[model samples]
Target chain A: MRIFTAVVAIAAGILILGGYFFPAFEGMQALLLNWAVILAGAAALVGIFNLVSVHTDKIRRQEKGSVYSALLLISLVATFLFAMILRPNHATMKIVLSGIIIPVEASLMGLLTISLLYAAVRLLRRRADLTSIIFLVTAALLILGSATLPFGNMPVLGTFVGPWITQVLALGGARGILIGVALGTLTTGLRVLFGADRPYGGN
Target chain B: MIELTIILVSAALLFGITLWKRKSPANLREIPALTRLHRTLGLSIEDGTRLHISLGTGSLLDARGGSALAGLAMLRHIAERTSVSDKPSVASAGDPTLGLLTQDTLQAGYQAAGVEELYVPTSGRVTGLSPFGYAAGAMNISQNENVSANIIIGHFGPEAALLTEASDRDNVTMIGASDELSGQSVLFASTQDSLIGEELFATGAYLGAGASHVASLTVQDILRWLVILALLGGAAVKLVGMI
Candidate 1:
């Protein structure tokens, strides 16, 4: 069964990838992608069902944190029902989006700021390596450079060092990583195509 | 035409190296993070602690799915190695298709371990669709589940910091990797062992998934050198033209 799956997958991948160079295979590529999208959509529905079922079972068994499970299900069903009846554009729906969802996400972002700061402060203590020192120093310089004091902007660190570090050093490192990641992505896809590594459960 | 040529060359190189290196052991360089993972894998089986694997929200329908697939590959390797533990490993994914695939991968891993009946569908979860929602859901698992180590590899944004805090607070070992540069930066600072850049994609190879995984790394190195030469060649040619 795994072999059959791998064969089909390899063929599909080859055809789809070949479509870019050979115009004749474009239709098949598009068709396969469409099929994939549809399958993904169906899989999403199944995923939702699985999530609900998992939580539902949790509640049924009176597991630890059963209240949270029940709350999740209730909110999930209620929000879904409300959106269905009142329409997504309705005031209540808008409240759910703007009031609950947006604020919650924003709060998390706020938490991220604090957590990032905390991580940076504790970084030296944790690793204390040369890389850690460089990372912390660069981060500190960047933060300091981005801010303007109550009196006036600094001359060196603010204007010169900041732009040089960001535009040259940071940009160069980021581009290097991007290129490596591109190569990695390419090989990964190729590995799948040649049936070397199958994340699709064939191996 | 150039892209297609590159693809064909990569495919050829991958196939060639894989076949050539089939009998001989792959000489992969030591990555500290991966070494820790290897030790941790053994410890998990010995001490009966579950590993929480969070595959970030990368939809399979798009280009971002590459990291997600890599995560799945590592998940398969981890699941198989740890299936016999008193507590089996659990996986979480943010995207639905990826989540479903993780479930299949987990089951397949257990099957390979000859413990098909021990497979639990709920062990693989679709945590949430949104980024933070997914992080939040998986965060609960890291804290609540009998997880000693958290392996987060895939696509993540700043929300990854949230998981970092969870791991840190719980004193759980976390080895995080992501295709996102920002995610990498966060994980690098927070987690002691973080795979950076292409290293995230190297998880399967590092974990000994198969020869192809190692072959892909070799091909990546060849391509990287080729790309460097191309850039330098282009620059030299342009300089000569100006001269």
Candidate 2:
């Protein structure tokens, strides 16, 4: 099994790299990549089946915390059916996505505010470190600078100072995050390409 | 043909270097947590510390393939270890696709271990469509289930803190790794072992569950070196131009 997997992986990588370097073989390579993507898409059904089967059993057994399972199943099945059967146009789909799914997702995201605040408070309880101090201080300033309103009515210190502090940290933090993300992506991509990491099938 | 030849040549060169290596260190397989994953799982089975795995809400496509792959690798490792030990494990997934892959991995691992009946779909539960709901559901499992060790890996967002907080509160020995820094920060604050960036990519290899993941790490290191050189060279050129 291991040998077979290794052989297939080597072949696939060769094909993929071949497609990248050889413009003449682009069509075949592109087709292979497309198939790889399509295969992944097909594999998604495995996930859907797992979701349905698990939730259905929970609903049947009426287990503890099964209500959430039920809700998840209903939402999933409803969305799938709505999309498949209704055949909603792009505009309508957008409305459903934005109005229902987005709001729920966003509100859930908003719930993170409480979690982050809680996490922040927990950090404050810990032994002081430079990283923690920096994190806490930046978080506090960011929160205060943004939430504190009526800057125009306040003194120059309130208006200019708050905005400047927030903007500088926000921009720098954003850049750092971008760099970290890019490096992470590059590393992950290389891993996949080199057959260093195979998540598809297990040992 | 040319590209394939180049790749083969480079791989051969690397293979030769590894074979003919001047001794840098005695140990090549010296990752602490990754080594611990297999060891801990085997030990926990006898001790009865149920494995808790949470796959975050970000879909494979949402987090761009890598997160999904990482999550799957983790699933395979836990599944195999637990199956071998005849221990129970819970896999709670935020995304539907992840839930499915995890389920399959669990079942297959059990089957491989010749305990196919123990492989339950409920083991890989799809908790919620949204983040909070998923977090809440996953936390409920950690609280209610006999889970001894909590392992959270994937594309967790803000709700990651909530889940980690609950895991910490439960006094569960946890290993949390995420591609997102915010999630990583939250996990690092709360959990014992938290992998950041490319380290997350090494989880599979380190666990000895996925050789490809190890190979991937090697490739990642090479890419990093290339990127560093490119950046340094570009900066040097720019400096020269300014001069």
- Enumerate the chain B TM-scores of all models: 0.98, 0.84
State the lDDT at B42 in candidate 2.
Answer: 74
Q: Number of the top candidate by lDDT?
A: 1
Question: For model 1, how does the per-residue alpha-carbon lDDT over B1-243 read when each residue is reduced to its tens digit?
Answer: 889889889989989998877887989899889999999899988988999999999988788888988898899899889888899998999999999999999988998899999999999999898998899889988887778999899999889999999999999999999999999999999988899999988888888898888888999999999989988999999989963
Name the runs in model 2 displaced over 4 angstroms: A1-10, A36-41, A71-100, A126-128, A145-147, A152-197, B1-43, B57-63, B85-87, B92-100, B111-117, B125-137, B168-171, B188-193, B208-230
DockQ of each: 0.79, 0.33
RMSD (Å) of each candidate, 1 decimal: 1.5, 5.0
RMSD of 2: 5.0
lDDT score for candidate 1 against the true structure: 0.90
| Model 1 CAPRI quality | medium
**In model 1, which regions exceed 4 Å deviation?**
B241-243
Point to the candidate with the largest TM-score.
1
lDDT of 1 at B125: 97
